[model samples]
Target: MTTNSKYNFKWEDLGDIRLGRPNLGTNTHVAVYRLMQYTMRDVLEKQLGPDKTNLFFIDAGFKAGVEFCKNILDCTLGFDDFGANLADKLLEFGIGVLRFEKADLEKMSFLLTVGEDLDCSGLPYSGVAFCDYDEGFIAGIMHQYTNLNFEVKEIDCWGTGDRTCRFAVELAKS
Candidate 1:
């Protein structure tokens, strides 16, 4: 896919939320967020089909994750500290509760879980994992942190009858 020369996203594009919504602030109902997400998915699926639509969401989420890491996270810390900071930031932003279930620093692989995920925490079982965006999001964050490509896959999700979203992250085989 070719990059859009006309418009490229940057962290500054988010603008000053505090100035924009003085009273309401940055918080919004989860239902409102889910409405936008689900509606966008529906429209994209209709136009592009499921696989391509999933790719688009993953790509968009990757971009968002890269920018979020650059703008919101401290990248200079050690791995454990960085993970802690990431978890804290996720919670602070009301995104989710992040935890590392397993980590192999030698292999650069991890099993991470997100509880109350912004994407699919309470979703009913649909016999499929529905956190493609989150998969890319984690990969993007790891890319920024380690300066290496990663393959991130969601093996379990609320959509798959799991209470939390679980991802398997590993270095991308080049």
Candidate 2:
């Protein structure tokens, strides 16, 4: 699928991620959601590992994954590059899950977890395949979005059982 096409959205517990012409002006909210997915699948998988089964834990994982990717994207690439500019790359290349959390809705602050499964699949599961899936998604994201060429010097993660991880994004000087 093309970037425009691949740029799909799945509002978990919402629907089948169908996309129609923007009934609303910019669909910024949806755009952000798509970016979150890209972050989780691309960046987090490398740091955390891939394995997508155990849908139950995926929700929590998405939170962690998205935050981690965002900090790096924001501090290193900036919102435009990380968001709009990166959209095509993200859709085309794909990155592993980065893991993220909503630090603040008003300020749009986020945190990335360091340890523990972001997906919170809870140790011991139905085959390690699930773990691989999450990791795989993250890998895909990396393949897709690394063009920005940003290095995440350090990441601090926290939380237990689907909690937000506090994070800091260190950038590489150009």
Candidate 3:
């Protein structure tokens, strides 16, 4: 399948989309989290339908997180650059240059919920949010993306790996 059709995403006139940084913590992987959010937009929008809902499965624990992040980083930035600290890269990139940290749970989990909501059968262009924590990041991105805000909650999962946690920013969409 074509990338556009496979991911269920479509180009919008919103210009460039960026995610706000989350409060830092040892477990907070902000860059990776943000990357997932934006990428999900593309995935669902392209693979499903412009107005279709989405579902996102997230890694529940730490060990799985490491592997998830590694795989995602390698896929997006390559194995060598994957070793590069994402926080440092974000700080270096400065404002307007968003990064997704692999450990940022609130952001990451929030995205998963929203993605699932989007994947669900519901109102077109409208969606729900579910997460392992509060929906702070979901609201943050909604405000950041469409000037809207939303609520979120956590969803339990049978902790698994084999998923990538790579961070991405909308460079440009064709």
State the TM-score for model 3: 0.19
| Best candidate according to TM-score | 1
lDDT per residue as tens, model 3, 91-152: 34331122333333244222231111211212222223323221232233323332223333
Candidate 2 differs from the real structure by a C-alpha RMSD in angstroms, to one decimal, of 13.0
Better of 1 and 2 by lDDT: 1
Pick the winner on TM-score between candidates 1 and 2: 1
Listed in order, each prediction's TM-score against the native is 0.96, 0.24, 0.19
Candidate ranking under lDDT, highest first, comes to: 1, 2, 3
Worst window of 10 by summed lDDT in candidate 1: 1-10
Q: Backbone collision count in every prediction?
A: 0, 51, 32
RMSD in angstroms, candidate 1? 2.6
Between 1 and 3, whose lDDT is larger? 1
Best by lDDT: 1
